[model samples]
Every structure is written in structure tokens, then in C-alpha cells.
Target: MWKCLERVLCLNCAFAFAIILARTGASPVIVNGALGYSVSLSPLTSVSQGIDEVVWRRLSPRMKLARCSQGSVQYFNTNYTNRITLHYRNFSLEIHDLRKEDAAEYEVITATGNTGNEHSELFQLKVYGLVSGAHITVQGIFGICNLTLICTVTSGDPTFTWWRNGEALVNDSTQHIRVLGNMLEVHHAAEVKYAVYKCEASNPISKATAEIKLRDVCKLDTSDPLPNSSICAEFQATRSSAATGSF
Candidate 1:
């Protein structure tokens, strides 16, 4: 394992024995749900008051992941209050129904509940997007029509699901979408059907979604807004972790 070190000086200390602080290079520390991403510093300690706030802000000037303060968690500012899942136990933040706006570098701040003295670290998060198209590609012998829907999303290990008229397409044979190289193929598509097809792509730490509407021969692709329920779940799950800056 590769390692790096940082030192702190307490010149006026009363204790005879010196305290040593060694820091390794951003090493791999595991967090829940996020597969490969790791915390640079794991198992951080706080003074007697315990932890108070955990704020994950974009490294730059972009929107930040939800933050947990005191006893409550908030999302995307005020309008999204109580819409985030927080895991304060481990200081981890999870944002569900992620959006493109959520993409960017992030700073995680941890503070002592009583004194409010804080420490923070930064991380980078990238959001992925998808492309989709659909049309009446074939016509049956009688009046039947075969519609094909094609969807392509970025990033590896992306999961694809199909929806029609806001209903999840559960039948594998008729309304199934095939996943291939970040692309989804739907065979025997319905003609003159009006519905929405959504592709949600995510890694353990971050998530993004893309949607397309099927209407006649016209195809419209758009980004789905972050859902309130998903945001709430993300906040609650990560609140504890965020509060303490733990695994």
C-alpha cells in the first residue's frame, strides 16, 4: 500500500511525550453502497460534543449534495427540506434521483455539535447522461405496427428500465428493453403510442437519469428532475456518515 504523511506541531504543549499525526495519500476507504469510491480519511475523531453538521458542497460553485445539520437534513436548498437521506453514523451522503446539476466536485464538512469547530475534505463527482430514440420502424401484415426504441447512456455498469404512460413495463417478452454497450433496444415497439421511457444511470456515490417520450414519429429526449422521495432517502442514508466523517 502506498502512503504519504503530514505533521502537526504543538510547540507549547505541556505533555512530555510528543504527538505524531501521519496522513496517507487519498487511500481507499469503503463506504456503503458506493462500490469503488473511498473516503480519503476514514474513522475520523471528534471532541467531546460529538458531531453537529455535515455539508457536502460542490468543490467549485455548483449545487451541493444534501447536508445534515443539528437533528435534521436538507436537500438542494430549502425547497427540498427533509428530502435527503443521511447516514450520520458513518458520515456518508446518498442522493437519489440524481440530476445533471448535481455533477461537480464536492466538499464534505464535519463540525463538533457543541463548539461548531469544523474540518472538511473534498471529492469529485461526475453525472452521466443518455440518448434515446424511437419510431415506427416496421408495419405488420394487417394493421399492426412494430415500434423500436433505442436508448444509449454513458458510464459503465449502467442499468436500463422502460416505462410506458408512467407505468413500468414489467413484461419481458413484449415491452422489454435490451442493454448493450450502454444502449437499450426495444423490439416490436408499439405504434402511435404516447409514453415515457426513462434510463437511470448511477454508480455507488452518484446517480443521473434520462427520459424520452414516444409519440407518433417524433422522439423527444429530456432529463428527469430529481425526485423528492429519492432525495429524502439519499439524505437519511448519508446523514450519519456526514455528521461524523466516518466510513
Candidate 2:
């Protein structure tokens, strides 16, 4: 009978411990970090006096990052050696020289000695590359309808934004303008003859802008013969002009 009673007590204690853990759980907060940069994960609640220990951990592929107790800090995991800092006052964790592999879910647990209570906070880290080399490329004839200007970037996952005459452009069916992901299509090319168009590409870390002028791209050579001229003569004339200019 005593053995059965002891078993019942153990089961009750296990159930109570599960409830305590559930109450201390928290939703993960998203934190954005740039590659090769440093980012800090702050605790949701301030560390109070009489707290005995603070433990920082990475959840996935579980690893203990650091532990603090009695005004002393202990570092774990050779992967994070010399790259992490634990602030005593606030118990915030700072990771330096962030890498793509550093993106993961982190947890901070604080335990109070007197009360034997523990609280935990979670953070989800996301790393992004810097935006660079953004430029605009044109398609179709300059004077023709359905002209398209495409925004291209050399690196980074970026969002595209279009601007015309310094004003933000959006999808306006009335104006015959469409703003697709990285392409800006204008059904009426004449409407933009005197306007300057700009394409801005950006990510969480950086941004770049490129501009274009329709007049410059569509400039015509005044020296060229009229459209009515014979094709054979036009080719010969153009070759002769180029030969004379070489001198």
C-alpha cells in the first residue's frame, strides 16, 4: 500500500512540474540581424535581485550558449566561443560577427534561488545579406506602347519600389501603369516622356536606387538620312560617315 501511495505522489509532482513549465513558456519574438554584424537578444522581463542563475541556450540542434551565476559567467559551445557577450545588468545576449548558420531560435532562462521559480523568453533570429548593385534595364522600343523597365540587383533578397517624378508609383489601371514584382510596365509611353523614373531596391539591412530618363535613352541621331532613303544607300552612307570620323 505504501509503495502505491508513493507512486501516486510522484505522478502528482510530475504533473505539477509540467504545469510550471507551461506557465513559463513564451512566444518567440522575431529579431533581424545582418550578416557579419552583431545583434542582441533582450529578455522580456528585467532580471531581479536574488536571481541565482541565468542560462542562455539555442533550441534547435540544442546547445548551451552561456550560463551566469553569482556574478560570474560561463561560456559553452566552441562554435560561439569569443563571439558572445552576456550583459550582467539586463542579462541580454549579444552575438558578434553573425553568420548564416547563426540564424536559429534562442532561449533565456532566469531562475530565482529563494523562490525556486524560473522564467524563460524565446527569440527567433533571422540573418539577411546587404543589398547592393541595383540598376534598371529597359525593354521594347522607347516610343512604343507597353514599355517595360525592369529592376535588377546583384545581391540580396530585396523588395522593389517604383517612383516617377519623385512620387511613389502604384498600380493604377486608369493611368495604364502596372507595378509587378521587379518590372514596371507603362501602357502609354508618351505619358512618361518628360518624367524621370527611379527604382529602389531594399532589404532589412540596406537599400539602393537607380534612375532613368526616357529622353536620353530614346535620343535620335540628327545626321541619319530620312526614313524614305534607300536601305543600300543608308548602309553605305553610315559606313562612309564612320570611316571619315575615324580620322
Candidate 3:
């Protein structure tokens, strides 16, 4: 048995200790899944001369999930059934329909029969629910779309992605668009006019999207002189922004 040096680590803090682990290199396994999503954990070497056994364990609960030897795999934990598949060709552990309880550090220990040597790999799995109330608001101009599109989600952790007409949005000054965290600054470009903007919030297991076409949501007439109209000032602002080539 290889002697174990005990240390506590969370995935978020794994990077600080990545260079210390030579067997797994300096890369931290960032496996995140939303609730009810699936994730896989694989050993560093898929094609090693391992003739003995492989063990998969969850460090938090000290639960042995699977054991494989001589190409035969066994599940010691009944909590996993169709949810796990060791036959995934890469000697990887696959867990399906993840639950929050499944979040923990996972370790893969392999023993070589001929050399009587054991090697280990460690990583953390974080599971969370999807973001609720995923929506965007337009603040600034109207027809020119030169406005700040702020995306708001109930959850603070899920990654946020912005899309326009099914295409992912990128922050390029040439394209007159900028993405700053959850806020998207849009300029009136050929691609920005009247296009639907989608904000997607997702975790490993859950994904939610909300889209809004500001043009459709706010009707403005540049010719409308009525100052009392809610959108009249927006139109005036759009005209002013048009000089900046935003229109």
C-alpha cells in the first residue's frame, strides 16, 4: 500500500495544490453538474499496464463506489445502479442523474499486479440546482439597441451565457458588443437590430434560458413628439446614439 498524506481540498481550492500532485499533473478536474445531471471521472492513464484492480471511492463519506479487476466491474454501493457505468471504455466512472448528495471528492486508486504499485488521482465534484428567474433587462437606448442588457438570475453560481438568434455572443469592439460578467452592452449593429437576445444559466445538471427581443417589447416611434410617451425619450436617445454609428 502506498502511504497516504492526508489533506483537505475543495475543487474551488484545488488549483493551489495542483502543482503538488505529480501523478495527475497540474490540472484540476473541474467536474460540475447540475442536479439530475451526469458526470464522469477518469483516471490519469487510460492505457497503463495495470493487471490488478481499480477502486473508486468518495472521500467525504468514505464510500467505495466501484471495484474492477480482470475486466470485471462490481458496484459495492447499491445506491448506484443504472446510474453508473464502468464499461465506458476509458476506465472512467460515469454517474447519471446526479443529486446534490453526490457532490464530493472522488478518488481513483489503481494497483498494478506485476509491479505491486498503486497510483491515485483525486478531484472534486460540485453539484447545484439551476438558476431561477433567468432574465434580461434593456437599459439605455431603444431602436439602436445601444443599451446595457443586464442578465439577472436567482442563483449566483451558475455560469451565464448570452446568445443572439441562437448564436453565442462574443465581446468584440469591432462588433460593437461587450460582455462584462452578467451584463451585455449592445450597440446598434447590423446583427443587433431586432434580434432576440437569450440569457442561459446552467449548472452541470440543469439549464434554463430566457430571451427578450427589446424591439418587440418596447415600441418606439422617432416621429412621436409626445414627450409624455414612455418611449419618446428612448427614441430620442436612440437618435443621439445613432451618430456614434450604433444604428
Best by lDDT: 2
Candidate 2 to truth, TM: 0.74
Q: What TM-score does structure 3 among the candidates reach?
A: 0.51
TM-score of each: 0.33, 0.74, 0.51
Off by over 4 Å in 1: 1-49, 62-65, 76-83, 113-117, 129-247
Which one wins by lDDT: 1 or 2?
2
TM-score of 1: 0.33
How well is each residue in 63-133 modelled by candidate 1, as lDDT tens digits?
Answer: 66566776676667542244345565666665544455554555567777665456655555544432222
Better of 2 and 3 by lDDT: 2
Cα lDDT tens digits for candidate 3, 46-151: 6456547888888788889888888889898877767877752567888888877888888887777886666678878877765566766667745444678777
Of candidates 3 and 2, the better by TM-score: 2
Ranking by TM-score: 2, 3, 1
lDDT of 3 at 164: 73
Count clashes in each candidate, considering only residues at least 3 apart in sequence or on different chains. Answer: 33, 0, 4
lDDT of 2 by residue, 1-247 (tens): 9999999999989977875774455578888887777889998657655678999999998999999998899999999999999887789999988889999999988888887767778889988776777777766543245568788877677898888778889877347679997899866544344557788887766777777755532343435553431221111000000110001
In angstroms, how far off is 72's CA in candidate 2? 1.7
